[model samples]
Target: MFNIPASNIAHIIQLAVAPVFLLAGIGGILNVVATRLARVVDRVRSLERDLPEADPDQLEVGMRELAILDRRMGVCHWSIALSTVAALLICLVVMILFITDLVALNFAIPVSLLFIAAMVSLTLGLSLFLFEVTIATRFVRVDEQYIMRRRLL
Candidate 1:
């Protein structure tokens, strides 16, 4: 009810603060990973659109790059998905913190579990992001022209 004592209210707010900040950090991570996923999808779509009538050599090279892009996209998708789940779990933990204090029940175990789950999900998401980055590196086109200019000088 609305009869929460001022000190209890202050303590509850204090307990909630850390989780709220964690939620904010998770939100930022989710935003970045989601943007990366969207870019991957966009690249795949562009490649698919152009693959149909490409010249023979272009088709071969394009298909190879497309395959790599597909793998990269899969990892990106997983990263985004896991980050989303982590964000959800973090939100749940924050809610549970409030509810436990309000109802006079022990929240230690459940809140810990939820926080751990969120961390695991976030870790996996970041790992996928790392894997995708390495995959992306495989397809990056370096500026040979720039290097050649240095050689010529």
Candidate 2:
């Protein structure tokens, strides 16, 4: 049997559960951000591929769209990086929980700090994702598309 008492181990597991859940949530966020990044990249590549055949006026529009896509891609990348860091910090917190229990040491302060840092990182990542979404909506030619559809109809 492990040197730590079963009750102590159980307590540590209980304490670790919340952080583990947080890690899973972070993972989900990362997945969404990664997918967004992939889509942005694909769009950029498609625009670039078509640029050469574009008329002068169309080329200008394509370039502007490419710039916006570039910004979105950068935002997605940062969101993913920060979320990943948060996930790693959470993993460390869980590891420390087990270590502290086994050694019977006071690690409450460090654990709390790590958890806070992870939250901060996740918040920033989520904020960036929001910003990217905003940019996507802001630059979209919704009115133009609507008019075009109406005319076709």
Candidate 3:
């Protein structure tokens, strides 16, 4: 039911092109985040499966690692969710642009707000991703934890 004016169609498409690029970038981020999320999940699951049979001497260390992985999973999950929301908002912005032209409706404010919100979501998501990566790297070695514990004491 798009009765978009022929004269306005080109302009609308041109305006929407920018958001289309945003959507593409968000999709790329989501893909990379999802892949990393999958790997984290697999490792967490493997650790859990092996925990019961873990050497008694190493059980505590294994459990501690598992806890860190769980936190990472939560962070990763929200990062993915936020990225998805940002992508959806970008999609809505593109749709609003076309709808604005088709119905001669004022959508500038809505479009701007949606675009801004999408950007904020992406920013927050990426920040959390960075935090998760930092945490992931921090505990990579057994000796690192002892050093961190000493610093905290």
Candidate 4:
């Protein structure tokens, strides 16, 4: 109802601020994960398009790289999913903050649990991002020219 005190409302707003900031951070993470996923898809499409014209050795190397890219694409997908879940959980935390203030019910346990789950989900998503990057760097083939130049140094 409309009987809630202004000071209580202000306090609720104060409680909500942290979760809102957490939501913004999650949004940024989602953007990066989505961009990586798109890039991986683009690379996969490009490789598929050129596969028919590739010579045998080129085809073999391309196929191998394509497999690695495919794994990267999957990892990016899972990371995005988990990051999205975290963002959604943070949103729930914010809403629950307001609801608890308005209805005068204790939601502290639920809010704490939600925030913890959000952090766990975000951590797992970031770990997957790190794993994806590791896989990508592992398969990166330095140009022979670059290696020869380094050797000359």
Candidate 5:
């Protein structure tokens, strides 16, 4: 018969908190990238609309920058998506391990499993958050501003 102490439970809770930090960090980074991309897109669109008759050389430069930004954004999105999936899988595995450990009445196993789960979950959440906050939201805002600016001009 294995009796788990309250302190152990507390420890687990603490471990669980690790994910929040990871998520926040990842979100921050993603947000920055997204914002920059959005700005670039906006600039390209603005140039296209407001300066339709501008010199071909200037137009070409804007188009090139837009293309590069688009490619980068796409790569970032896919990378984040893949990482999130992997993290989820790791979390799932940890859950399974915990369950198995519990069934066996192996305190050590469950504790280890929980620890792993917490770590994996934290990583996944952080990565997803980063991508959403840094890249995705910024991109949208930039695009919106660009469109509005072009319209007004």
Candidate 6:
């Protein structure tokens, strides 16, 4: 029931603006990953500095484990970053298509349906990414458990 003209260029402008939202979302995810990695690196450095020098072999083993943990976290961080970028790109494409359809039909029933679908897809993707980040933070708890066990022995 929208009265916007089929030939209106406002839809094109809206489509162009939609990518900014996608970029912002991607940037947010990257920022979270970067912050998390920095904290992990800082914790590892602290462990290295604080560890006692009494047992060289034990220290070496601890350092090796820390290195492995760092590598694994780095891989995960990169993987999340890449997926965020990819999802953002996909959302941008979908937004463009939704806007194109809206313009062609002047916001008719089919265009409204497409718009709803696009919004739902974007929301679901964002939610899943958030869940992944939450789960990833549990890795810190695992590291803490290892530290506790080491202290016990």
lDDT of 2 by residue, 1-153 (tens): 366678888998999899888988988999999999999999999999999999999999999999999999999999999999899999999999999888878999999999899989999999999999999999985678789999999
The TM-scores, one per candidate, come to 0.89, 0.91, 0.87, 0.94, 0.46, 0.46
Q: List the residue pairs that clash in candidate 4.
A: none
Task: Give stretches of model 2 more than 4 Å off.
Answer: 145-153
Let me know the TM-score candidate 4 reaches against the reference structure. 0.94
Q: After superposition, how far is residue 4 of candidate 2 from its true place, in Å?
A: 1.9
Model 4 misplaced regions, further than 4 Å:
150-153
Kindly indicate the candidate among 2 and 4 with the higher TM-score. 4
Local distance difference test, each candidate: 0.86, 0.92, 0.88, 0.92, 0.56, 0.60
For candidate 1, what is the TM-score?
Answer: 0.89
TM for candidate 5 is 0.46
Q: Candidate 6 at 131: error in angstroms? A: 10
Error of 6 at 128 (Å): 11
Q: Model 4 misses residue 107 by how many Å?
A: 1.3
Error in Å for residue 150 of model 4? 5.2
In Å, residue 22's CA in model 4 sits off its true spot by: 0.8
**Alpha carbon lDDT at 110, candidate 6:** 51
Q: How far is 61's C-alpha from truth in model 2 (Å)?
A: 0.4
Predicted candidate 3 versus true structure: per-residue lDDT over 67-87, tens digit per residue: 998898899999999999999
Reference-based lDDT, residue 99, model 5? 51
State which candidate, 3 or 5, has the greater lDDT: 3
Give residue 69's lDDT in candidate 1 (0 to 100).
80
- Scanning candidate 4 in windows of ten residues, the lowest lDDT window is 18-27
Cα deviation at 1, candidate 6, in Å, is 32
- Displacement of residue 19 (Cα, Å) in model 5 is 3.0
